[model samples]
Target: MDFYHESVLLKETIESLNIKEDGIYLDGTVGGGGHSSEILKKLGQKGLLIGLDQDIAAINKSQETLSQISDNYKLFKTNYENFEEVLDSLNIEKIDGFLLDLGVSSFQFDKGDRGFSYKVDAKLDMRMNQDSSFSAYDIVNGYSKEEISKILWDYADEKWANRIAEFIVNARKTKKITTTFELVEIIKNAIPASARRKKGHPAKKTFQALRIETNNEINILRNTLDRMIDRLRPQGRICVISFHSLEDRIVKDTFRYKFLDCICPKEAPVCVCDKEREINIITRKPITPSEEELKNNNRSHSAKLRVAEKI
Candidate 1:
């Protein structure tokens, strides 16, 4: 399927980056090159834009779209979790700016075959990278009931996690839960009818949790944020667009810790820890999409853009 992702907080992110004409920039999640195209437009011929994405479709689509902008652009077909390795392989020492738009792209969801959406009745496959061995199919059919419960509760914050996990375990005992519809039915059966009537979809949270676990999305984002910060040059900015609260929490906490001057308790007489501040939080609060953006694209409603400048 053709790659497509609505760039959430596009103008806010671009402005937050404060793009320099000759600066080096990186879009760690270059889905469809939407933001990259804008960043490149603000750059001079000497400037560079490094793009990374695990999805082959994103890589191909972004490459094709970004090619027209400048040869100064480079695309990496790798997870954003490996941002340091990506930079090292390219002989890039310090990045002037970087951006990460976390979570699955619109293409992954809307493209019927990828199976990222519970709304679709496709096969249960949610591997961001096609080469990855683990998929939603494996998790549903192979994982223990306890593990499934933990995944849904922790990742999705679903109140019916335990019931859903029990239902899945029971259903799979008869036959492997191999399709989206099968899993959706299991989720519907698990959730209380009264509660299901209030929310958007019964399967939404469970499916989200499974996809996150399958891709190691939360852990990867948590681990990579600090390392990515380290690779930035002083005054350089890192802009992250997070779709969910889990991803946003990581970005928010990381930014706070990096920008904090003191690690000591308030009762302490003198500062002991010699931790130096690495960044200044550019967005005191994450910048959400404007009303117009939301009206035009419903996908941007949950999106939040957080930026921090290296100190």
Candidate 2:
């Protein structure tokens, strides 16, 4: 399958990076190398671009796309959670800029066999890396009803999580939920008819919750943000595009804390604590896709791009 993903907010994200001609940049989630291609376009021969993705397919496809242009970089088939270690191994102590586009790539959803889309009928597998031991099947069949409900409600904000979890538990008892279509049918039956008639697909949120859980998405994002910020050179910037409210909230809060870390009490403001600000928030509010971009690609509707510069 062709590694195809329309880079969301392409120009906007690259512009936010303020790319330096000879500086080093990292694309932590370099899906299909779309944004990475644009990043390399702005670099001189001395500039370096590191592309990272856990999916072997993505790494292969992105390398094929980028190899035609420049070879002054590296590609890694590893999770972004270990980006700090990867950089250290490369002898790169700091970066001039970095980017992270969080969420499943279009390739994963388009290739039905990967089981990322609710519309597709495939096996219940949602591992970003094929080597992962657990997949969506494990969560759907083995997780307790309460655990499933919590993931659905917290990760996807699905209001009918309780009913969906009940339905899943009941179905699994009769037979293991091994395929995507079976789970989709169960989800449809669990939701009310009126609710099913609503705008979006009924199984969207449930599938999103399962994928996140299967890949450990939320925790990885929360844990990696601070470490990535620490790796930026003075005055270097980091831009992140998150596809859900939970991810956006984590990025926003991390940026806020890093910029306003002086936790001196208001009552006695004599600077008792020695904490100092690390980065300055560049975007007061996240930049969303323009109406034109939305019309071109609706998948970009949920994307929120936030930027910060290391102090």
For residue 297, what is the lDDT in candidate 2?
94
TM-score of each predicted structure versus truth = 0.97, 0.98
Off by over 4 Å in 1: none
Given candidate 2, what's the lDDT at residue 105? 79
lDDT of 1 by residue, 1-311 (tens): 67888788888999999999999999988989999999998999889999998998999999899889778888989998887887888898998998988857889998888889988889999999999988999999999999999999889899998899999999998999988988999889988899899848888899899899999999998888999899899999999998888889999999999988899999999999988889989889889888899999988888989999998
TM-score of candidate 1 to 2 decimals: 0.97
Compare the candidates by TM-score and give the number of the best one. 2
The C-alpha lDDT values of all candidates are 0.90, 0.93
RMSD of candidates 1 onward, in order? 1.2, 0.9
Which run of 10 residues does model 1 get worst, by summed lDDT? 1-10
